[model samples]
Target: MRYPAVAGMFYPSNPHELIEMIEHCYMHRLGPKDMPSLGCYEKPIGLICPHAGYVYSGPIKAHSYYALSKRSDPMEETTVVILGPNHTGLGSGVSVMDDVWKTPLGEVEADKEFVNLLWRECEIIDLDETAHLNEHSIEVQLPFLQHLEMLNIIKFKIVPICMMFQDYETAVEVGYFIAKIAEELNRRVVIIASTDLSHYEPQEIANKKDMIVIRDILNMDEKQLYEDVVNYNISMCGYGPAIAMMRAMKELGYGEARLLAYATSGDVSGDYSAVVGYSSIIVE
Candidate 1:
């Protein structure tokens, strides 16, 4: 498999260093001083996490994975389906992998049966491995799963979808369809919306914009979320995926969402002039 794009720049090319870094991040927890435990659930439906680098987004990422790990089910029964934005503009719709996705930590085998099943059901799906080649949106979340040991036992498959030519209704429809399949099959699946909030803006402005998006999302108001993005010109990297996740979570019986953590690149780099926002949220 040719792993192209931002391999060395976004993350370390050396396998050992990459593993060490992910492990280190896992060791350090992030969140409120009095954060409550996530506890366990039968089939936790969705997660929204940032896709920034380990240094900038690592703590927030840790909060996400740690919450996931706190769930009751053993790792073996969990199936992770990651939906991310298409930064490369290569794949127009959903793209599923036919083989294992290799990272510096190790290889994550694609659940071929599920991938094919999705393609058969969804008209907009395709088998395009190249779509994932250079996309850090999906890759950045792998190490967190790996460090939690969820990678080894979980019967997980990655569906790297790039939403294009689709509206909020389309995202809702697709999300409901996936939820129906999971219910019918009696499978425990987890959906992850890989995204970041506002892009390069002053810290204060970025915070304001991100809060608007977050409020809409927490209220389960997909239309308001879209409107806020369009009205404010908020450049959130994963708005499509976030909309889809909200739709799917509602279908799967989750009625509430809580913001787990929120921060920005400025918090890490100490630069307030230009910053990108990061947030971790859970649907329950």
Candidate 2:
């Protein structure tokens, strides 16, 4: 069983409060919102979201799920593959769990069949739950998904993978492996890369670094993303997962990517001296 490790800290521990926080995220919107109409895209293929505290990043994350809720077919058999950074350094290079994840909202069963197929196709992936035991990057996104289910928008299982080696080569191999699994299973899959941008930097510096990372992602240049992160010292925790998702989308013939929202913790706390950046992006 995968119990929530950061519920009361990163988000609310109570289910009601959790739902309220997510609902409040949807109620508010940042300016110049340009999400496509409901039928604009057949569905969302991948998302890049932040995993910071809900108070600072919830609204930005809402754009990722809101767009998803609009286009997803409620009746389809869908599985969300979430890739997060392994901040805790406890498991394999790529750890995939085959257990139910428990949150304040409820339990989300793992897509074991899909995950097993992934393990077979990718040599890097391992069946390990310890890495996720104390990690919040992937856990923080569950309530948003649970809220969607509560509203009857969509019901789906999950494939949660945590990446400890955020390197471009590993990302490519993993991305292609995911694409192979999707093709083999012929299932509707949505990939989510969970990451928070520049951490504890002044707001201006954080934005500058994050913009570079965002540009590379929008350009769909996985190698460049890795190079920029290293060369420029961008503190994007999940760049490996993001690059993996980008490579996977390209391999699967996806063409467009959109920047839904971008904000800094300063946006909420009014403290620009040292802020963490957050952004929401979708690839299709």
Candidate 3:
């Protein structure tokens, strides 16, 4: 079993506290005022969300989950493929974890079949659990998913991938293969790229710098995004994962992306001198 890595740190360890914290996130001033509603039928292909502490980035993450819950139909056979940057440098350049993930809400089963298939077909993707053992980027995302599951809004098996290398070449290759295999198998896939933008910069500078990368994402230009990251030194932590998820969407014929919300840690802490920018964007 993959135990919770950031359970007590990033979020609450107690199950009750965890649930309340998630609810508070939904009701936060920056978050979507109302709870998730199954009002639409168009499924989302990909999303870009910030992976930070609940007090800092959870509201921002809520925006993405709210967008996810919009699909009116039940997500029966859906697989959530989460791609996060390897902050801890513990495993392969591109690694996938095949194990049941435990969270406060309950245990979520990994899509072993999906893992096995991708490992065989994608030469660059290695099966490694060490990368995820101490990585909070992917683990922090589970509570939101677990909250959604508790609501019976969706049911899914997850396939977690950690990218230690966020280079353009590796990201593009990984994204391409994920879409390729899912399409071949006729499987429904929803991708979530875990990221935070413009870390520890002044609010004004962070917004300006992040906007450049955000524009590239909204335009669905992964190459230009990489360029923006490199040329501007944007400090976006998960650009590689974003690039990968964007590539997968493009492969699956998604052309447009909508920015649901954008905010900074300063907004919550009232410390504008230096802050981390977070955004929630969904691809349609």
* Candidate 2 C-alpha lDDT tens digits along 26-96: 76555224332232226538999999999889888888988787767666657899999999989888989
Evaluated against the true structure, the overall lDDT of model 3 is: 0.90
Q: Write candidate 3's Cα lDDT for 1-284 as tens digits.
A: 99998889999999999999999999999999879866444554799999999999999999999988876346565788999999998989999988999988889898888888888899989999989999999899988887887787877889999999999999999999989878877777889999999999999999999899999999999999999999998999999999999999999988689999999999999999999999999997
Top-TM-score candidate index: 3
Q: How close is candidate 3 to the true structure, as a TM-score?
A: 0.97
lDDT of each: 0.74, 0.86, 0.90
TM-score of 2: 0.95
The parts of candidate 2 lying over 4 Å away from their true place are 29-44
Model 1 agreement with the true structure over 1-284: per-residue lDDT tens digits: 52534546666667778766665655644543322233455665688899888888877776777677666354455667788887877764666666776776667766566777776787766777767777788888876676555333234555556565346776776677667766766667788888999999999999999999999988988889888898999989888888888887888888588898899999878999999999999886
Error of 3 at 25 (Å): 0.8
- The residue pairs in collision within model 1 are 40-72
Better of 1 and 3 by lDDT: 3
* TM-score between candidate 1 and the true structure: 0.89
